[model samples]
Structures are given as structure tokens and as C-alpha cells.
Target: MLGSLFQKFKDGLRKNTPTFQKFFGKVGGLFAAKLDAATIDELEEALFAADFGVETTEEILGEIRAAYRNNKDLRGQDAAKIGATVLSRVLEGAEGQFSPNPEHHPEVIALIGVNGAGKTTTAAKLAWRLQQEGQKVILGACDTFRAAANAQINTWAERLNVEIVSSQHGADSAAVAYDTLQAAKSRGYNVAILDTAGRLHTKGHLLEELKKLGRVVQKLDTSAPHHRWLVVDGSLGSNSIEQARVFHESFGLTGLVITKLDGTSRGGALVGIYRSLKLPVYFVGLGEKPEDLQPFSTTAYVEALFG
Candidate 1:
């Protein structure tokens, strides 16, 4: 299962890595062999095309150029070495903060996003991860407006063997969330993962519904819903940024969980999101399976992207 996820990551990297046309025709052989300005430009374009984004690519190229200026003797493998170094430097400190606070009582995690953003799936995956850590979890189906939403959480609950609190369809989601928190308290569950309805970010009514859910959770534990995660489909490209903006404005998102990353070529959206929101990327969904939901690690991600 995980092998396929890793393979997809590898495939994305291979497809996006420096194209043969630029690498072989323009940059000479694997050995650096003293590259000229034109060759450097080609290399830069290749990285940008690979979705490294212009700023990241230029920063990397700048580092390579600076290194070359200091040591003119640098050649084929030397160029590759410096290129990798620059990439590593650019992505060096971009690590993920995936560890949820186990000490916090009822570590409430409220997952929110637009329809088809993979919010329910991510909630289930996160709940599974928490259960694996030996924490008793309660899955809260706060998306009461959608019939399938309740069934979705129930399915995950059965599969994970965790308890869930849900209500009838078209019920007040905030009331569901409130009742769920009390249930978690009474049942002594260590965590509560609330799955809110998925609506277009432009929908004011739906967005206000999420805010109300937040207020309800806060009423119970004050720190309830400690984490408001926005699940984004990486395949949506730049639109993910706009979606995030709407959610952040409405719910004050704490972090992001990007899904379908392996299926998209515009991986630059990750960088764009970080640049635009400055929120930590908590996790990424690489595939459809539960286990395919992998914790986001910026270092390993850069390596996989350049592989």
C-alpha cells in the first residue's frame, strides 16, 4: 500500500525533474565541464518547469552560480552536487509539525474544506494515526447537513473500531459538535476528530456554519477544536490558494492537509500555499487508501521531488 504511494511520489519527481532536452542537449554531460550562462539559464528553466516555482528555482540557481564563481574548476558531477546542495538549502528547514499534542485533553481536531477536498478521508486517516499511537479517539460527524457525510464517518468508525457521535441529516452541525464533545468527555476518549460539511469556500452560509461549530466546541473545552485543519486537493493547483484564503478568513485555519499531491504536476502549489498563508502543512494524502495519507516532511519531500 505504502509502496504505491512512494512510487507515485517517485513518478512525480521523475516526470518533473530536469528534462532530457535541457540536461543532455544544453548542460553537456553528467560531469559539469564548465557550464556557460546559456546552459545555466536552461537549467533554471527546467527547475521552474518542474514546479519548483520561479523564486525557488532562481534562489537555487543563484546558490549554484555563487559556488561556481568561487571554484571555476567545478564540472559535471560537481554541478549536480551543487544543484542538489542548493535544493537542500532551499528546503532545509521546511520540516512538518505533525505531532499532535497527546497531553491535551480531548485533543479536538476540526477538519474543514470544500466539497471533494478529501476532508472526511483525512479525518479518518488522522484518527487512524492517533489510534495507532494508542489514543482512544471519538469521531464526530458534524457535517449533519449531508446524508452521506454521516455515513462516511460511520464507515470509518466501524473500520477503525472507534466511537462516533452523529445526528440526523439537516440538523444543526454546531449542535452535533457540541453533543459530540460531551460524549467524548463522558466516554473518556482522548481525542475528538470532527468532520464538518464540505462546501465551496465562496458559500457564506456554509462558512458561517463552520465558524459556529468552532464557537460551540470552544464553549465546551475552551481549547476545544484546538486544530482547525483545511484539507486541500493538490490537484486544484492555484485555486487551492483561493480556497485557503476563504477558509482562513472564516475559520482561522490552524494548518493544512493537502490531498492528491501525487496525482498533480503543479506541486508548486505547496510552495505557493506556504508563501500565501504561512500555515504549517500537517499531512498529505498521496493516494486513496488510508495508509497512503502520509505525514508531511519537507526535507524528504524535496528529495523525492528531485529524485
Candidate 2:
């Protein structure tokens, strides 16, 4: 039973990762026998194509080249192992950690990002995850900027049987957050997850509105919104780095939750985002299912890509 469950977990992580697996099949050998000049070039190109970023790509290739120089017969398996080691080193300390603080009753977690980054679905998934762990979680549909946002979150709240606080379209989003936290505190809820509007991250006014939401929530618990996670679309590759930087500058984001990795060919962007901001990745959308929103695991990620 345990083995079957573990295999299913790994299969889920490998969704749409066949390109990578085919490239580095069976321990290694995208090329035959020995590491030659042409094979080395191919490896470099593959890493770059996977969106490993220039810095990381160079580092991995540099190490492999050095190894080849030492041993003219350096097999692809050895080279692949070396590349995975370098990547694992770069992604060190990138996993996020969290626990409900007893002092901060109803610790707030604000999910922020641009539209189509899967914030609403991620919000619902996270709420369900927390509840499964016995945390009294409540959803806060604080995205008053879009009417559909309110309706979508409401639907998930009903499906998950989780309580939520929301307002009409164009209502004050900060006010919704304030009320959500207040309700969580009064009713003894352990955590309140706030689903913020999909701010474009470029508009000055939109970011200012995000700042206001933060300030308003602090009035309730001072340390409310303890987890300001920026939900990013992994398919955008390094393009997401600049957007995340903008949100981080304005909102002082605490962590990241990268979504859409289940289908993105450029899943390596997670490394660039972490390298740029040094924020821990709290969760990743490995698939569309609610159960597929798994916690960030460096081991699982490197294994999936390198194997």
C-alpha cells in the first residue's frame, strides 16, 4: 500500500515532465558512451531550454566540462549526477515551512499575484489542505475588484464546506480582510486565508491598494497576514521574476507558491524566482487536483527533473 501511494505521488510530480525525462533517460545518455564536444553542447542547450537561467546553466556546464577534462571517458550518468548536484546546491534553502502560531490566533495568509496565476483555486486548495491537518481554516474572498472572483471563491468555499467572508464587487478589499480576520478571531478559527485580487503588479494604484490591505489587517492581529505568498505562473519562466520583484517591493512578500508546474515545460523558473528573491516556496501546483497542491520538496523536484 505504501509503495503504491509513493508511486502515485511520483507519477503526479512527473506530469508533463516527459520531455525532461526523455532527454536524460535511465540515469543518463541523451548521447552515447562518452562525453564528446557535441554531447556537451547538447547538454548545455537542454539546460537552457528547460529555463534553468544563464547563471545556473553555466555553473552546471562548467562543472561537467571540468569533470570531462579530468576523465576523457566521463559517462553521461556521471555528468547527469554532477548537474543535479549543482542544481540542488543552487536551490538549497528554497523550501518553505510554516506552523500555526498559538499566539496569533487565526494567522492570516494572503495569496497575491496577477490574473490566471491560479490564485483562487490555490486558495481553496490550501484551505482544504489546512483543514485536513486539523487547522480551523476559513476562506476570505477579499478580491472585490472582480465580481467573478467573489463568485468563484464562494463556490469553492461551498464545495469544501469551509466558511468565508466576502463583499460585493468593487467593495473595499481591505475591509473584507479586516472582517475575515475579525470573524476568525471571534469564532476561534485557527487560520484565515485571504484570497486577494489579481493585481497586475505594474499599476502603482493597484500595488498601493495591496499595501492598504496589509495595513488594514495588521490592525486586527498586528502579525496578521503572516504569510504573504506571491502565487506565480511557472509557465512564464524568468518573466515572472520581475513581476515578483514588484510585488515583493510593494508588499514585502514572505514566500512564494508557484502554480501551473503540472504542464509547464519551463518548470525550472522556480529556481530563478528563488534565486532572485530568496523566498521559500511554500507549495506548488503539481496537477489540477486539489490533492496535487503539494508542499515544496527539493528532493522530489530535483529527482523529477534529473531522473
Give the top-scoring candidate (TM-score): 2
Candidate 2, residue 123: lDDT: 93
Task: Mark the regions of model 1 whose C-alpha exceeds 4 Å error after superposition.
Answer: 1-7, 16-39, 68-94, 100-103, 200-202
Deviation (Å) of 288 in candidate 1: 1.3
Candidate 2: C-alpha lDDT? 0.83
What is the Cα-based TM-score of model 2?
0.92
Candidate 1 Cα deviation (angstroms), residue 38: 4.1
> lDDT tens string, model 1, 1-307?
4444656765664455545223422334434356667767777766665566667667767877887788776554555555566656654434457555767668888999888999888888888887887888888888887798889889988987778899998898999889888988888887888998986344898888888888888888887788888899887766678879988987888888888888566665677676677787888888877788887776556545543
In candidate 2, what are the lDDT values of residues 1-307, reduced to their tens digit? 2233223434533454554454466644453367788888878877777788998989989999999999999877777788789989999999897788888888889999988998999999999988999999988998998888899999999998889999999899999999999999899998899998886445887788889999999998787789999999887889999999999998899999988776566777789899999999999876666776878888777766674
lDDT (C-alpha) at residue 53 in model 2: 91
The model with the greatest lDDT is 2
Off by over 4 Å in 2: 1-22, 27-32, 200-202
